[model samples]
Target: MTETIHPTTESANRYLRDNFAPVREELTATDLTVTGRLPDHLDGRYLRIGPNPLDDPGDQHHWFLGEGMVHGVRIRDGHAEWYRNRWVRSAAVADSLGEPHRGTPGERDFAANTNVLEHHGRTLALVEAGAPPYELTHDLDTVGPCDFGGTLPSIPGRPGYAAHPHRDPGTGELHALSYNWTAGNRVAYSVLGNDGRIRRSVDVEVHGSPMMHDFALTERHVVILDLPVTFDIATATEDVPRLVRPLVRGLLNRVIGRNPLPEPVIARIARGGDAVSLPYRWNPDYPARIGIMPRDGDSASVRWFEIAPCYVFHTLNAYDDGDTVVVDVIRHPTMFATVLNGPNEGPAVLTRFTLDLRTGQARETGIDQRSQEFPRHDERLTGRRHRYGWAVGFEDGAPGDTLLRHDLDTGSTESRRLGAGLEASEFCFVPNPDGTAEDDGVLMGYVHDRAEGRSQLRVLDAATLDDVATVHLPGRVPAGFHGNWAPEGADLADV
Candidate 1:
């Protein structure tokens, strides 16, 4: 169960302060206003979920650690039907909102606030921490946690799922590399069939409790990014006692590198790197690695490739060409290198790393020069080579007013700018009805206008980078992590 320690003070973290303040109230209104014409085929809900803590987030208030709330807008037949917002209804959040909690709190509460997607006919709220997903109805209400209709394997200890699971367009199979922080040096790879039943589960070995936020799933292999940023229990200030600092450090040292314990307990006390210092820290001794394990094989089939020490939170796409595997991602120089105040690092640029299986060498190159994050591609082209990538551009770590469309086939990019003082989130491409070309689709997502304090749903033509329409909303929806377009009465397609 989640700890019920009520923080008495407001958070000092940058993410919870200023313009990024959390919205406490939830509302539902019918017949939302539309500023421009919406597409006729755009008949579905546009849902985005992010952290919005209800109460004051005390000392350890990282932006990522706040409670999850989802904002949604429903559009049908070129008309705005309604807009609504609701918290995921976790145990703590339910108690705060005076609603009924739907499921028993596992080792960790279900934040369910990271990303929202429809898979196997179920809409799910997802987070990276070891918590089962909270299901949502088409109207955006919490339907409670799910376990693949009771077909998922019991994780034995702390059960969890990846917030960003990959689906293969060819087979409709969803694959996830689920990791549990409590289970140090261990991770699980699970495959769910098109029927939303667990098909396979394999336990994989790792060095420490590294944060594997995202991975690459190709047709032949699963790319594992085991980086240096590890989970240090000492950072959970509420859990660790003052007298246990030395004991924690000794145990951590042994777990990471198999180092011998120091004979004298109080030989030295360092400023950082000690277990009692930060909730999470960087491990310089750990070599950043990329493992390519066969899609159908076990952990023993993995082939390891070493890369420079860095951190990555997302990957756009990956494909295999002959003996080499090419993966594109947003690369950060370092994360939590010194302190985990927030993402104080420089802008994450779009970079590609190619791993050659025959030679066992990896080379990194720049895909696009612009600083961007939340990269996405046509779902039809996932796990294979195709053109077109879309991402939100960044300025000073905040999403800028432009959406970038990259044409990998032609080695060129086109950008569509939202109005000034407006920022756009990740956009999903909905293919034109019966369209054959990959770029023949409309990109739709949420765009917030800070000056007016309102947000709207924008649909853009994928091939021309032109604005097709904007369905306006009543209030500003906070910028979220990831989202997808769920077209009504249609299967998952590239449009």
Candidate 2:
């Protein structure tokens, strides 16, 4: 039996309510229920990570500031073994739960909340900005912060790595353009070798600390998106939500009733939050450009190409075509333009870009003008040319009941609209062992039922975008960021 469950925390913030709210405790359920035939060839685990704050931060809470919780489902021998959800225990989480802290001491109290993936032999929960990644055991317990066996060197307390790293399918190496807020104008172009340690790290000069969430990769070059959204001090100090602004202003006015505080003082006191959790916002003054750097060369060989104003949180895939670089991305018209509490600037659009290496010019083309984000393609096609892409759709900034597949070669789209009150998260493609084509595999991710108030693991045929099977989770997994299929091989614990 299932029932609709709602967050009991009192807050006017939509991010702290309904399906976006955090679950209170960790849970483990065994021998899960299945609605269809479980694919025996699919022998692996599916994991996802996102912000799930333990306590509400009230009106000042930002959606990206919460602690992380990882949700995983294990499959083996055609049986759904179990489902588990565990918080990526930073020091703050450990101290709150009364459990002793594990792992190397962190430079700051932070959340490893954006993504979870296995690199080499270690499973890591990763976040951006300055915080280091927290290692996790096979069962998802915190193993402590990892520094690539102390090879991912950082400056003083700053660990300059990104949450999104592009792995070369052919070489088994990982590539990233990472930045830290304190790093000022230079971002590192880092490459992790097959052994999972930083083999090459070069500091590439840029205008300022841009939010380098994700980038593009081709065979010979790494594409850097030095876009308009950037770090801003005023966004942290004064940007509050319009809905709750009156409540804050009224309270400040009542506090200084006898003395009558000045207008500037009242405004500052009303908008200020407890701390500077995330300081990034849309910056129009910053020029939007793309930097093309050789994978085999250094920062001295980097070439920059300017583009129109926009911001991107993710990219589908990129490849080299003759002397041009082709990349597909979900582009937002603007971000954090009117509100600071959450993303008020999208229903993002899917677009394709062609960059001429010789002329240093860029051409942007619209693929799908609908409201969609969280784009994914088969990992086998990463950093290379591909035919298809998949993403979860959003309607007017809310989870739309649609899943999409696009044929880049033909410019045709296929969509699978879900039943009422059912919302889907980012679906990742798992390749078939004997498959011949790109779409010859299964797509897997979470699906939440609003009426039942419980979420489930859903599998779909990638080619037709049809339902294949479902593994009901033990509880509701809040909407999250990114994850991948950790195909079963040698046990990860032994790796």
Q: What lDDT would each prediction earn against the true structure?
A: 0.76, 0.80
* Residue range 1-495, candidate 1, lDDT tens digits: 222212212556656653356775687878876766787877878888887878876555666766788888888888889998888888777888788888655435656778888887788898874678888888888877777877653343332678888888877777888876555577778887877788888877777678888999888999999999876645633344568766766565564322222323212222232232235667787789999999878878889999999888999899999999999899988888854756657778888899999999999988888888888898877889867898889887777888898888777888877878788888887887779998898888888777666677888888887878887776667767788877676664322
C-alpha TM-scores of all predictions: 0.90, 0.90
Best-performing candidate as measured by lDDT: 2
Candidate 2 stretches with Cα past 4 Å from truth are 2-4, 8-10, 154-159, 235-273, 490-495
Q: Write one digit per residue (lDDT tens) for candidate 2, span 1-495.
A: 655665444667777877788888799999999888878898778989989997666766778888999999999877889899999888888888999888765554466898898878778888887577888987888988888879875443233678998888877677888876555566778888867788988877777667888898999899889987776644434445667666654653343212223445434633454653467878898899888888877778888888899989999999999999998999998887777767658669899989998888899999998889889998878888999999988976757679999999999998999779888888999888799999999999998887788898999999998888899876898877888887767342222
Best by TM-score: 2
Worst 10 residues of 1 by lDDT: 265-274
Colliding pairs, model 2? 103-144
Number of colliding residue pairs in model 1 = 4
What's the residue-level lDDT of 203 in candidate 2?
A: 76
